[model samples]
Target chain A: DAGVTQSPTHLIKTRGQHVTLRCSPISGHKSVSWYQQVLGQGPQFIFQYYEKEERGRGNFPDRFSARQFPNYSSELNVNALLLGDSALYLCASSADSFSYNSPLHFGNGTRLTVT
Target chain B: QQQVKQSPQSLIVQKGGISIINCAYENTAFDYFPWYQQFPGKGPALLIAIRPDVSEKKEGRFTISFNKSAKQFSLHIMDSQPGDSATYFCAAEDDKIIFGKGTRLHILP
Candidate 1:
């Protein structure tokens, strides 16, 4: 089976601009989460969506937002991007929302470079 | 405060030797612990995982040792190889996952 897939493998944006990253979860998966990994750092959660509803959010600012489609695909939108926003955006998906043992499968990630 | 703290930003080990990485978490509620391995230009993939209920879990050459009382966990790679060189991240999951800063492991041939 195909793992999680993300679109526009790479992206470039300017300060104050906006960017949208897309993710398609594996078949039969109902939950997707977004994370940003900066150089030399671990991923920081941005948002999570399951069954078309917001399940959880991280400490990111309002500038970061996300939505899940009925098909379980997800999109992350970053508004007024800052240079600091340049990082690898990772998308991970799990089979269910509440399963304690649900292991997340991740996509290769979209590398965002904001100048 | 960082919810999870990982030590020794980087590690180097000779082939066939053992390489260990440590991490400690502050949230006692975190019952699930997992380790992820990532290569250059690729996202992290699950290496191994353990729950507080288990003291240690071994999958092939990788093992996760969990200390529930101390809220600390570690990963040990046995018979290290150049192929094992990558970045390793320790994570704790409660409602969601909190990841450590990550450790870069380089196994020399």
Candidate 2:
């Protein structure tokens, strides 16, 4: 099966503008999570959606929000982009909540650049 | 309290050697521990993971050693090769996944 896929492989936007990122989970998977990986650092959890409901949210600001579709796809929206928002936005999917039997598979990621 | 601290920041080793990376977590609720490998321009891929109930788990040349009591774990790469070079991240998970800063491993051929 194809791995998790993310759209607009790369994006550029001005500070204070808004950006929307999209992700399609692997077939049969019902969970999708978003993370931000700043340069020289590991990924930080942003949000997680399961079965069209908000299952978990990270420490990100209100400007960062996400929603899941009936088909299990997801979109991450960031408002008032800051230069600090420049980083690789990653999307990972799991068959279910992460457990010993089920793990996360990630997409290449959408590189968001805020100038 | 949800941070997973990883070390060595970076490492360089000769081929056929052993590569080790260490991590410590402050969140006792983290029940699952996993290691991820990331190459430039790509997302991280899960390498191996272990539960708190086990002391060790191995797959091929990759091994995860967990010390539950100490809240620490480490990743061991046996017979390391140049292909093994990449940024490796250690993560702890419960309701959400938290990752370490990452360790850049460079294996010399």
Candidate 3:
């Protein structure tokens, strides 16, 4: 079975531009979450969606937004990207949002570079 | 406030030696602790996890040691090998998951 998958393995955008990263959850998974990992640092939670509903959000600014489709896929959109926004964007999926303890399976992640 | 803190920032160990990474969390609501391993150019994967109710959990050469009272936990890698070299992150989960800064572990032969 395939694990989580993400599109646009690597992207380079100029400052003040917008970017959208996509993610597909594993089969039968209903929960999807997004994280941002800066170089030499761990992944930080950004947003989480379950059953196409916004379940939780992190401390990120309004420029960062995400939505999950009915099919359980997710998209993370960042507006007016800054150089600091450059990082590896990760997408994780789980069986459900209530089972937070259930380990999250991650995709290869989209590497975004704001130039 | 940082909910979870991990150290050391980097570690170097000889092959077959034990490598230990420690983490402390501030939230009492955190009942689940998990350790993730991430290689260069890849996403973090679950290595092993432990609940506050258990003192320890082992899988192969990886082990998780949990301390409920002190709110501290650690990951111990025994008989480490070069392939084990990567960034290890410890996370605490309450309503949301909070991760540590991560430790870069290098096991040299």
Candidate 4:
């Protein structure tokens, strides 16, 4: 089975532009979460969706938004991107969101470079 | 506190030696702790995980020692090899995962 899949492996955008990154979770997975990792830093949580509903959100600004579809796919959108927004956006999936023991499976991630 | 603090931003160990990475968390509510290993240009993969109820857990050459009272946990890689060279992250789980800054481990051949 595929672990997790993400599209647009690498992206480049200008400041103040908008970008959307997509993710497809493993089959039979129902939860999808987003994280942002800057250079030389650990990934920071962005948003988590379970069963097509937003379950949790991190400290990101309003410019960042995400939604999960019925099929368990997800899309992360960033508007008015800034140079600071340049980072690796990762998508993770789990069997369920309520189980702490459920390990997360991650995708390779989309590398976004804002210039 | 919501942060998970990890130490030794980088480490160098000889082959057949042990590599240890430490982490401390301030949140007492965190029940699950996990370690992830990541290679360059790839996403992190779960290495090993432990819960507060257990003092220690081992898998293969990897081990996790957890101290609930001290809110500390560490990962021990036995007989470290060059193939184990990668970035390791310690994380605590609550509503979301709180990840440590990360530790870059290098094993000399």
**What is the per-residue lDDT of model 3 for residues A1-115, given as tens digits with 9 covering 90 to 100?**
9999999999999999999999999999999999999988789999999899999999999999999998999999999999999999999999978544466999999999999
Model 4 C-alpha lDDT versus the unseen true structure: 0.94
RMSD of 2: 1.0
- Give lDDT tens digits, candidate 2, residues B44-86: 9999999999999999999999999999999999999999999
True contacts kept of each: 0.68, 0.95, 0.79, 0.79
> What lDDT does the true structure give each of the candidates?
0.93, 0.94, 0.93, 0.94
For model 4, the DockQ equals 0.78
Which ten contiguous residues of candidate 3 chain A have the minimum total lDDT?
Answer: A94-103
- Candidate 4 per-residue lDDT, tens place, B1-109, comes to 4489998999999999999999999989988999999999999999999889999999999999999999899999999999999999999988889899999999999
Better of 3 and 4 by lDDT: 4
Model 1 residue B103 lDDT? 96
What lDDT tens digits, residue by residue, belong to model 1 across residues A1-115? 8899999999999999999999999999999999999999999888889998999999999999999999999999999999999999999999887435688888999999999
- Model 4 residue B54 CA deviation (Å) reads 0.7
DockQ values, each candidate:
0.71, 0.88, 0.75, 0.78
Candidate of highest DockQ: 2
Give TM-score values for chain A, per-prediction.
0.97, 0.97, 0.96, 0.97
* lDDT of each residue in A1-115, candidate 4, tens digit only: 8889999999999999999999999999999999999999999999999999999999999999999998999999999999999999999999989536578999999999999
- Clashing residue pairs found in predicted model 3: none
Which portions of model 1 show Cα errors greater than 4 Å?
none
